[model samples]
Target: MLQAREGTCNWKANAASGMAVHDDCKLRFLELKAKRTHRFIVFKIEEKQKQVVVEKVGEPTQNYDDFTASLPVDECRYAVYDFDFVTAENCQKSRIFFIAWSPDTSRVRSKMIYASSKDRFKRELDGIQVELQATDPTEMGLDVIKSRAN
Candidate 1:
């Protein structure tokens, strides 16, 4: 298992719930947010490693549906999406959202881990405009996202 080290402090010791956010997770998010190289990114905690990792990356051309579909039906995940929409004024706008996907059917332990580590992981990815926690698909639907974006 890989351990993240910063100065003399082990990430596991300083991080919330002893879970560390992997460096690649932040790097990938920067690519998506700053460079617009990706539409979204799915992240999962490796139980054995006790670290958050990038599980998948949606291509720039992928739609919101694709981002939603990437999440497992019975698993907990962390994701970031670049949401684009037109405001009531007909002006185009974009928002970067940090989504916490914890479905009802997922294991309780998984949910606990994700819930505990979310803040630590989120802090690594700079410039997230909104945060959404969804227990079902409907909670993160396009309409809901658009409302949040506006």
Candidate 2:
């Protein structure tokens, strides 16, 4: 439980119809439950160009569709994923917003994923394509962002 000092949880289970309800209050409650997933990146994609400076490490998107961030989540830290030169399945086709995190408790080793789907964003990853890697980023929290110890 991650909760605001003066907050509460309201999980409404959608029964009878086998569905889900995203009430405003319920959404707030979900936010309260958010864990400080370390070092996860969230990119805001724009149309018609390569604005990032990362080495081409994967394929590109087809049917290019640029998207903006609906909201900024504190857990999401943005890092550019430059796929300009990549011969991906959909290069220059679909705009990509990469998000990654460490799905581990110890932080000694972790799994990282870079996906285009918002559902796969660093803040909320459920089912999406991701590239996993091993690294320790426990020290990569807000403090690290604020500190210039490089």
Each prediction's whole-model lDDT (CA): 0.92, 0.26
TM-score of each model, in listed order: 0.88, 0.19
Q: Provide the lDDT at 97 for model 1.
A: 97
| Alpha carbon deviation, residue 122, candidate 1 (Å) | 0.6
lDDT by residue (36-105, candidate 2, tens digit) is 1111223332213312112112222321112112212222223322212223354442112233433344
Report how far residue 34 has shifted in candidate 1, in Å.
1.0
Instruction: Please give the TM-score that candidate 1 achieves against the real structure.
Output: 0.88
How far does residue 54 in candidate 2 sit from its true spot (Å)? 17
The digit string of per-residue lDDT tens for model 1 on 1-150 reads 234345336655554558878899989998988899999999999999999999999999999999998999999999999998988899998899999999999999999889888987888899999999999999999999989998
Q: Summing lDDT over every window of 10 consecutive residues in candidate 2, give the lowest-scoring window.
A: 62-71
| Candidate 1 lDDT (Cα, 0 to 1) | 0.92
TM-score computed on alpha carbons, candidate 2 = 0.19
**Top candidate (lDDT):** 1
